[model samples]
Target: MIHNPNNILTAGKPLEEATKVMVMVHGRGGSARDMLSLSTYINDKDFAFVAPEASQHTWYPYSFLQPLQQNEPYLSSALNVLEMLRARLQSDFNLKPSQIYWLGFSQGACLTLEFLARNPMRYGGIFGLSGGLIGPEGTSRDYAGSFEQTPVFLGCSDTDAHIPKGRVLETEAVYQRMGADVTAKLYPGFPHTINEDELKIVNSLISGQ
Candidate 1:
């Protein structure tokens, strides 16, 4: 099922009974099961979690900073998977955009931010861990639509080898321009891993506090 949306893993509350839903995306080389582990930290008992596995556990073949076309059909396919999942949640579960949230790490984070920017709306919240928007520095961000004040959090290491702090800042600016309530933080000299402080923030966001 390469690039297919059928390979999905779910946890937390059953979809029929869930009041909130969070779509979690794993990074390159990561699996749906790995992404589901985050629910342990999210600790949102009422949330229904959905995680889609990518082909070969990777979203795109090339680096996100590479020219957009270089990522080709894989990038587009990955985005489409998200679209399908969103529609599924809405139609099947009677969930609204405001009842859904998104979280991703590294490559997954890039895709998450790109999707939100391309399809702007008011979501429960968005959390990008250790990542930034896709494409090189000069990629045109002329994306249309507004987030309508959706809460977005982006956290990364200042010296991350894969994600540059500059890109993280640029992503924050872009989301802000699109009317998202964005919060971005750079941990000085930190490793390329999620930190407890970030989890705290996520819990707070999930709690709507």
Candidate 2:
């Protein structure tokens, strides 16, 4: 049996009754409940929000920049968590990939992007706040498949203590190369936290306003 270490927290409309879905992933040391709180700011009545909890409130134990092997089965397990949620949305709620959005912050952002890279498709949207693709600087990202014009938003401070701006740009380039509609914003001297601008963009994206 594949151990699923995820406890999903949901908000907004039930999946079966909603037209849209948002799979929210939390940062390291953050809970699914905390990720669900963002739905209050998003405030999309037609959307079903699902947040998956990490075991012990952490998806992996090392920095995203560390070697892939170092993260090991924990990283693979985290990816499986997202996959399981996506499958549930498809099987139980009958939602399509294009109706599902991926959103995350910090370490969660890294995991979200990594999973997306491995499985590219036309998603509703993707929000990566203060994060980048996994692995070290010289890691090869020869991911197959295409995003098919999926809109992706990546926001990070130019001097974030945890993320490097270059990595964010690289992620943008990779997604764009895979046919995604990429929008990357670099905030100068901004703190390592989500800003009003990011929230506003997300609300607009999810609301179609």
Candidate 2 lDDT tens digits, 1-209 = 13254578899998779999999999998988989888888866788899998887888899999999998889999999898889889898899999999999999999999999999988999999999999999999999999998888999999998899999999999999999988899999999999999998887766662
Q: Candidates' TM-scores?
A: 0.98, 0.96
Q: Write the per-residue lDDT of candidate 1 for residues 1-209, one digit (tens) a residue.
A: 24989889999999999999999999999999999998988876889999999999999999889999999889999999999999999999999999999999999999999988999999999999998888988989999999899889999999999998999999999999999999899999999888999999888877773
**Candidate 2 TM-score, true structure as reference:** 0.96
TM-score of 1: 0.98
Task: Give the lDDT of residue 145 in candidate 1.
Answer: 92
Lowest summed-lDDT stretch of 10 residues in model 1?
200-209
lDDT of 1 at 167: 95
> Once superposed on the true structure, which residue ranges of model 2 sit more than 4 Å away at CA?
1-6
